[model samples]
Target: MNDTFTEADLAPDPQEKRDRLLAVADRVAALVAVLAGGVYIGGMIALGAGAAPIVFSMLPRSIAGDVMGAIFARFDAVALGAALAVLAAEVTRMVAARRRGRTILSRLRRSCTLFMAVCAAYVALSLSPRINDLHRQGVQRDDTPQGQVLEAVHKRAELFGKIGMGMAFGLVVLSVFTIQPRRAEDEEDDDEAAAPLPPGPRDD
Candidate 1:
């Protein structure tokens, strides 16, 4: 090797490469969760003005027949159930991890759990009013510019729901790597901690 050649140019260790890959995977999984949250929130805000409920709290019986009601109502509850299911899954993951004495990263991905919860909440909240509106006011209600914008919003909410699910799944898969197996040293520690207090209640 000549002075022109540098140590930095040497090949990287295989373990180091694997570590880098895992780090990148963790980061990417978190980013996906963030994006999923953004899409859901943006969609609800955009669509609530125009479409009303896009996926929950209401069921659309028809669309073109009632024109405004028919078209807008179609969006009321299509994806609502799926959104709720996702939320439930997230909540279960979080609660279960704590009770099991494990960190979220140990078996469940926290980023994914958070993304699911937020997205689910957004969908549920967004749909509740529209469901109420549809029942209170028939589909024939007047269509405003707000209604027009909301049409897009509902659609975006639906898209985000799918994306959120995908992100959550990816993060869950990644958590396998974060789950550390119990080592002999850990077993020894547990044994040491479990040794009974020396019948000190009477003496102390």
Candidate 2:
């Protein structure tokens, strides 16, 4: 019995394995980015279209504002988390794309994801705190100066939320279109083409 290993057998296998792993990672990252963006968009819609009206209609204005304010504060945390997840997933996909020798990082996609993150962070860190402070100060009425200021700030927050949701939706769409996994056979074919042919049997 003879045991021998050729360079051809060992050299190509590691690179092929690496390509396959990166492809799988890319797909997972794309899926995660899309799902996270969807969650953020859905939460915003549910809060604005469903919860706000019902809560305000059922409870007194002041109490409704308080309840909704609390919910919004909690959801700000959720939005920030979703944004971070999307950004992380996008970064992973970019790395995989670079490794695969493809340009999967579209500028529009990056811009949209970044815009979403910025809007979420702005609302969560900057605007939400102001709104919460106003709520705590019992400024629910819309007629007085402080109440008017609260209303203005609340409107601004709503505007930012809408913008963030729009960006999130756009990011999801761009990700679906841009970030795709290469077929396994395609990677294998590429690897085979790049690899050196096995040494032909010598004839004397």
Candidate 3:
């Protein structure tokens, strides 16, 4: 009996190895996107619904504003980071899916992801700083000009926050309902490949 291993036998198939790596990367990207999105959504809900009301009820308006402002300021960094993570993960997943000849996310999913990132950037980069500056300047009275300006800016910020939260919720829903299961997708591809082609015109 001959005991010999050829170079071809010793080496793994490059295509197979590449597919395996791509599969692993795809899973990782999906997991990262989900985790990051969850953190972003949970944080938004907590700050908006749970923390703000409680803090305002317990503390004076001015003090509560300051406290909430500070909390939001800290969370801005987190929100921005989480948003970036989600965007990166989704882009990675998109690339992986394209390589595999699969559709991982729909157009709506991509749009929502982009919108979420934009909203986070706007809040963190534009709105948060303005709010913080107003807080620092100290709005003495709600009726005064400075106070009114602060109120307007604060209201606008809240509006965007609420919009962002809604977008996040919609994204979660779309992800759950729209994304096809990998197994189902694979089976679909198999079915198509297995399907018989229409009979060619009979040769004379």
Candidate 4:
């Protein structure tokens, strides 16, 4: 084997690894934020539309009821999963941020947290009336009250969705700053951690 040596091959560079990892983390964080924002917006828009969602009837045995029931059962899970993703993405981004200075990410995190709360409220409000209806022995079938509650939920969903979009855009703004040349302290530590070794001989 030929004898050739370079600083890159000699030792494990922690800072380089950190830098690379940070870059990857930044990209992934941004992607997650964008997706979360889109989902939030879409969900909100649907909530705002006040349209009854239709599902294909599989069987004639109360097909509409079955589909509606299924949708209700699954809806919360879907929203919960989306909110969880945003929360997870925020946590991951926080971990990925290497150096000092809190930026728009903090605001984004707050926005995401609020968004999750809004989703939770939506789920809770949607179910409360149903639960109450079931509890009453001979309650009338009027769903006006339920509709009112649902409307309120829809409003929150739409508002939070817009807020999430703003926060996600803010994250993008902060990330742009991070990509620039780091401060001297940031540079100093990494550079000192892995100083160049003056001309060394190969000893494999």
Write down the TM-score of every candidate.
Answer: 0.37, 0.82, 0.76, 0.52
Please write out the lDDT profile of model 2 over residues 1-204, one tens digit for every residue.
557876765554777778778878878988998999999999999999999999999999989988988998999899999999999987887887774435444767888999999999999998889988888888875789998899888889989999999999999998888866577777787898899677998676
User: What's the C-alpha lDDT at position 146 in model 4?
Assistant: 55
Candidate 3, TM-score vs. the true structure? 0.76
Candidate 2 residue spans exceeding 4 A from truth: 1-12, 99-105, 181-204
Better of 1 and 3 by TM-score: 3
Question: Residue 107's C-alpha lDDT in candidate 1?
Answer: 40
Distance from true position, residue 139, model 4, in Å?
6.0
The lDDT for every candidate, in the order shown, is 0.48, 0.86, 0.76, 0.53
- Listing every candidate in turn, what is its Cα RMSD in Å to the true structure after a full C-alpha superposition? 15.3, 5.6, 7.9, 8.8
Per-residue lDDT tens digits for candidate 3, residues 118-167, read 88889988987887788878774389999888888878888888777776
lDDT of 1 by residue, 74-173 (tens): 4334334434544454444344333432664544465665565655556456743453354344433236654544455546556655555555565446
Evaluated against the true structure, the overall lDDT of model 2 is: 0.86
Number of clashes in every candidate structure? Answer: 11, 0, 0, 0
Best by TM-score: 2
Worst 10 residues of 2 by lDDT: 98-107
Tens digits of per-residue lDDT for model 4 on 145-172?
Answer: 7555544544554465456445544544
* Top candidate, metric lDDT: 2
Q: Which ranges in model 1 have alpha carbons more than 4 Å from their true place?
A: 1-108, 131-136, 139-147, 185-204
